[model samples]
Target: MPRLWDETVDAHRRAVRAATVEATAELVHEHGLRAVTMSQIAKRAGIGRATLYKYFSDMNSILVAWHEQQVTVHLEQLVSIKDGPGEAGARLCEVVTRYAEITRSSRSPHAFDFPDLHGHEHAVAAQRRLRELLGELIAEAAQSGAVRDDVAPAELAEYCRHALAAAFELPSDDAVHRLVAVVLAGLSASDARS
Candidate 1:
């Protein structure tokens, strides 16, 4: 009887996980992360609060899972661009642009949105990985002379990231591209004509 009970519990847990993913994806798509709530997810999933809690400790866990999934997709995209033939700046621009597009398209939740991961180990690790990748790419672009050397590669990468992420708030893609050019210019050597 105990073994049978354990099996049933495992099945229930699996069901809740599937429901959580579905509900989270839907809520984020429809209402954005800020508007999503634990209670709403539970109701949408047609599961009791207790059942939801049994599978996920809270909304933060679910959001983190979603972010992990998104990151997996983004990583694949980055890998393809990293290997693609092109100027370093163009490739880097492609990467940043795609990343910005992905973020803009989704109402997906960010790591900070989850209270449970506010200072979580996994969150810190993920951020570190992101910074390392950004820094490497920026440094590469600088070495290729496509980006200026005055500013640190990591700083350039971060600036590009921020600009792209906030692109939607800007008036146009032209504006965003111009902003990127400005950052690149700042990194380049001074313009001197003979």
Candidate 2:
């Protein structure tokens, strides 16, 4: 095929695949996950069932793809924040707060619904990157005496992760903010010295 023709074909395929993923998520949200089907997704996506199958093997695959996309988007958003201008401690707090909000607003209300998905390579990689980013920010903050120097940066990163995980179950944004503040307090070098 000609180069232009190939590019067009690839673009069209991406559009179809994106539409299918979006439609599957919408259907799963409207109906329950178990109640959604390939046919419904195909119809809603305005693509043939065969085309939908070409992109995904089954409903589970479609949901996984949708989840992976969400994870990627969330990671990208976090990366942007890490790159933005701010003091190390302020940036770390912003990243933690945003991550908490993301967790609270994630599509799957129940984390156990897709246990296997959490172990997927992309998800694992994204999580590792997040930890590393947090560690770097923690180290910078420690140097500036914004956070405690007693704990290793990596350990503090894990501590922050565990503390922020509570946001997933918190009742309100106020609670999440409070949780962030508490986590920051635990990391505060000034408070520890006082």
Candidate 3:
């Protein structure tokens, strides 16, 4: 086969896989995990059962694939905000707020808390990357005297992540924002001294 033909085929396969993942998520979200079926996923994904099976043998596999992709996208978003043009303090704040919001949005018991999705290599890698990004931002802010220098950036990074995980059960966006503010404040120089 020609190089162009191979490239086109690869792209088509990726598109089909993406469609299957998205369709499965939508169905699971609407009908709950136990209520969704492979046939429904195939129809919603605009593919035959065989085609869907070719991409994913089961719904759990589809969920894992979707979650891995989501982790990749979320990591990329955090990386962009960390590297975006802003003062260190401002960028750190944005990253913290975004991370909190992501935690809240991804809190679906239908998928996120599934046993199959836990302890996956990609998720572990994404988490490490997130912590690294957060640490970098905190260190930068510390250099600028916007954040506390007393605490190690790595420790502060862990603190921020653990603290923001509460957003998972928060009832409203306003509450999430308040939590973000408190997290950010805890990193401030004055708050650190208190």
Task: Write the residue-wise lDDT of candidate 3 on 26-124 in tens digits.
Answer: 887788888888999889989899988887888778878888999899888989999999899999999999999999987767644465554888888
Kindly report which residue stretches of model 1 are placed more than 4 angstroms away from their true locations once superposed: 1-19, 31-51, 102-123, 150-152, 158-168, 188-194
Write model 1 residue lDDT over 2-52, tens digit each, in one string.
Answer: 999999988977777877888988987788778888889999999988878
Q: What's the candidate order when arranged by decreasing lDDT?
A: 3, 2, 1
Instruction: Summing lDDT over every window of 10 consecutive residues in candidate 2, give the lowest-scoring window.
Output: 106-115
lDDT of each: 0.69, 0.85, 0.89
Q: Is candidate 2 or 3 superior in lDDT?
A: 3
RMSD in Å for all candidates: 5.8, 2.1, 1.9
Estimate the lDDT of model 3: 0.89
Candidate 2 per-residue lDDT over residues 1-194, each given as its tens digit: 69999999999988998999889778767877777889999999999999888888887777778888999999888888878998988887889899988877763554456547778888898889989988988899899878899889999999988788888788888988898889888988877676
Question: Where is the poorest 10-residue window by lDDT in model 3?
Answer: 109-118
* TM-score, cand. 1 vs. native: 0.61
Clashing pairs in 1: 148-187, 148-188, 149-187
In model 1, how large is the Cα lDDT of residue 54? 73
